[model samples]
Target chain A: MLEIINLHARVGDKQILNGISLQVRVGEVHAIMGPNGSGKSTLAQVLAGHPAYEVTAGQATFQGRDLLDLEPEERARAGLFLAFQYPVEIPGVSNAYFLRAALNEIRKARGQEELDPIDFMDLAEEKLKLVEWGPDILSRAVNAGFSGGEKKRNEILQMAVLEPTLAILDETDSGLDIDALRIVAEGVNRLRRPDNATVVVTHYQRLLNYIVPDFVHVIAAGRIVRSGGRELALELEAKGYEWLTEAVPA
Target chain B: MSRAILQDYQALHPQGAPQAGWLGRLRQRGLDRFQETGYPTSRDEDWRFVDLAPLTGAEFRVGGDSPAVRPEALAPYRYPGTECMLLVFVNGQFVPGLSDLGSVPAGVTVGSLASITARQTELLGHHLGRYAPIESSGFTALNTALIADGLLLHVARDVQVPRPIHALFVTAGDPAGLATHPRNLVVLEPGARASVIESYAGLSEGAYFTNAVTEAIVGDGAVLEYLKIQRESERAFHVGTTHMRHGRDSRGTSHSVSFGAALCRNNLDVVLDGPGVEAQMLGLYMGRDRQEVDNHTSLLHAHPNCSTREVYKGILDGRAHGVFNGKIYVTPIAQKTDAKQTNRALLLSDHARIDTKPQLEIFADDVKCTHGATVGALDQQASFYLKSRGVAGPLARKILTYAFAAEVLDEIPFPAVRESLEAVVMARLNARGE
Candidate 1:
């Protein structure tokens, strides 16, 4: 469902992601684990078409469309979603309003009928339960005063409603508590389908335990150094990133 | 002011030579002050940032009795769903013949300054020329000399007007082929409450000048929610001043929104005379093309246990320029005063400009006073976030900028007014493109 071929990207004058390649087939969940300086988050941001990150070389295709050529919003309408690691706190804009705008845009792009406020609220309520959050949070500004856990859950709520064909969850579990991690994982797990793919970017192996991945790739420096099945996550968890970096030649 | 135009215009109205007595004395004193003060040069501190050159060069049209005001002519804004009294004025003179006073509460006298100038001279004397009529500025002298009693509003003590009073001043193409002045005095007696909607509306496409002044006295414990909407014709020029004095425990909220006129200048001067007073001034301005809007606000906290908060936001597009100077003054006796102010500007076009200064002049050492000013474009990241969610670029920026201005609008107490203001802002944003 999603493919990256020799993807190399940079942010301004500094190159961040260098020669990284990965593929996720339908119905499969992939976890990319790496150290602090690793290009794991950069890959997610580049794929989402973040303006800061420049794609020096390589291409990413989602659903047979060249995703790199599309703007961030265009990529989103084409079924590519990026659950931000640190969701921007937009004061004065309510969560429900933001979500409705997003939903209407995507619907319009796909030539589907738009949903009114009443129907949009109904859909949002259903997805709110999937992430274990109530309507109170949406009533306030978008992530204005939300807690770390609430922000993470809000991201999942967006993912569930959009139901993207391919979702890139970057550091979703970093600041989340165990319960929030479980709720976010449950939301992602529920969206799993035979024709959709999910990429979970994390530093620790704990997130993978809750939302088990079919494959795990260890990233170091600017490239993916190792690739293995789900067990590889457990191995990295026991042995810290010290051994993982040593295994990669300078 | 050049040596050529330095000649006093007030010479037309000589010193009590042939006039109507003591009120004649005010006109004479005002004229003398105008001659002595001359035209306010930019050298004056108050007129420092504002350049009166354009206002001076723009054909200085004077008043003359020619074409009569027609009521049916004010078809542009027939504001419906309003139970309040409506006062309409053309140029500077109040047209009682064109107004609809309907059923005003007793003791509440609302009329044009011309009416007071002729009939109720005693009432006009008590407050007229109370403040410095002629500022040290050049334009101030010009307005003093040209003004024909803008409008008069007097609410007796404890008179609670249940409905709003809409004062519509329309600047039309010259009756005498000249400019106009709309000066007003609004005095809310002790314990009185009222809502005033002062609109600077346009009538013609002529390059007319609408120099206006509104002096309001918010008496003891009185609450005034004033909204000034400046939607003048792009061909007209506007220079306005709103001088307000708050009594003990009084509350005043002023929302000034200007979106029209070739060059618009607003001097919102408020002084908290009594203790336990609260004053909040909020405004939003949008400018485009060569249009210029300068908002000069000063809150003088002279008493103790007072609070004042101000927020002014400006959105500049094209090559338009916006100037915002928000100053808060805390005197020595004004202890335990809580004053906070913020001036923000969002420049959409690279060629647009904004000069903002959040001035805090504090003499009370124990008071809590804070001021901040920020000038920048929309948050690119937040716009990207919205765009990434499939919202168009222009719409995303509009949403963000609207959200920014909403912070100031949220301070308004009236929900209906808030809704209308929001709609007006949204419409303005929608009409422009990136």
Candidate 2:
């Protein structure tokens, strides 16, 4: 479903992602684990086409389309989603209104019929149950004064509503408590389908226990040095990343 | 140039009627004041940022008969869905044929100010020219000097007006150097409640001037909701002043929205004279092209236990310029006074500019007064967040800009008016073609 080959990206003068490559097939969940400053988040942002980061050299293809050539919104319309670590606060714009606008735009791009306000509200209400949230969040401003857990859950709710083919969860469990983490993981797991995939990026292995991944990859200095199954996450949690870094050649 | 404009006005109304009563004396006094201090120059402290050369250099003659206007031309300015009293003015003259004098309830009077001044001389004499002083502003003096016709609203004691009063002023005629001065007076007795909307619009896209003044007196325990909308021609110039006086325990709220005109200045002065008075001043101004919009507000807490809240926001694009100057004064005797003021501006282009100043004078030791100002561009993170959610770049910008403006519009109390104004603002923002 997604492919990256020797992705080289940088922010201004700092080279964050030196050389990275990864591939994910249909119905498979991939977890990219690394320590701090290991370009885990940068990979997700670069894939989402964040304007601050420039791809020095590399190729990223999603469903056989060059992802780097499309704009952020076009990439989104092409079934690419990135759940941000720090959600933005857009004051005076209700969540329902924002989501409806986004959905309509995406629908138009796909040559589908746009939903009216009444129909959109009905669909939103059904999706709200997946995140265990009530209808009040729909009327509030977009993440204006939301709690840390609420923002993360709101991101998941958007992902569910948009129904992207490939979703990149970038530190979605950073500030969440145990209960919130479980609920978020449950929400993500429920939305998974046979034709879709999820790439979870994390610094710790606690979130993986809830949403178990089929493949685990350890990235050190912007290069994937280790690849294994679900058991590799538990082994690294018990030993630590220092052992893996020491074993890899400089 | 200043003398020529004043001379043209004098030539139109050659002082033939014998000056007899207080009304005549008031007009004479206003004329004298205006003659003494002509149009304010850039050297004046309050007029530093705004230059009046465009207004003074033009030879705009006053007191001209307006051409006939079709009903369709007036539809855009009227609140069609809302049930309200309608009064239409063309070229500063009341047009009864075009006005809809709806059946007002008992103890309420809504009619032309000039026609009813003779019958209610005592009431008009006491309230007219009371709140807006003529000595400070030349535009106010000029308006007072040429106050012929406007809206006159009076509600008796304990009367609650069933519907709002909408006064629509349409400047339709040859816009070549035509000017109009409209004076409005609204008085609500004790325990009375009312809402008034004053709108100024133009039909032709030419050079005309509208100098307007509205004075409202809110009696003890009365509540008043006043809204003023200025949507003049792109080449027109508008100078308007709204002065309000609140009695003991009275409440007043003013929503001033400016969307058009080449050069516009709106002054809102509110005085809380009695204890337990509550006043709120909300304003929004959107400017584009080379348009200039300036809002100057003054809140005076003259009594104890009075509270005042003010928020004024501006959205400027292209090479447009905006100015916000808000002053809050707490007198020495006014203890327990609470006042809060905020001014925010969003500039969409690098050439767009905004100058904001918050002035606070608190002589009372026990009072609480806070003021803040912010000027910035749209948040990049917020824009990117919207774009990532499938909204295009241009649409994302429009959404953010509309959201920034909706903050102040949401404070309006009238639903129909609020919805209509929201639509207008959104339409204008979308038309930016960003």
> Largest DockQ belongs to which candidate?
2
DockQ agreement of candidate 1 with the native complex? 0.50
* Chain A, model 1: TM: 0.97
TM-score of each: 0.78, 0.81
Reference-based lDDT, residue B253, model 1: 93
Prediction-by-prediction clash tally: 5, 0
Docking class of 2: medium
Over the stretch B85-173, how does candidate 2's per-residue lDDT look in tens digits? Answer: 99999988899899997788999988999899889889989989988889869889888777778999999999999889999998997
Model 2 complex DockQ against the native: 0.53
TM-score of chain B of each: 0.90, 0.96
lDDT of 2 at B253: 92
Q: How good is the docking of model 1, by CAPRI class? A: medium
Clashes in predicted model 2: 0
lDDT of 2 by residue, A111-136 (tens): 99999999999999999999999999
Global fold similarity of model 2 (TM-score): 0.81
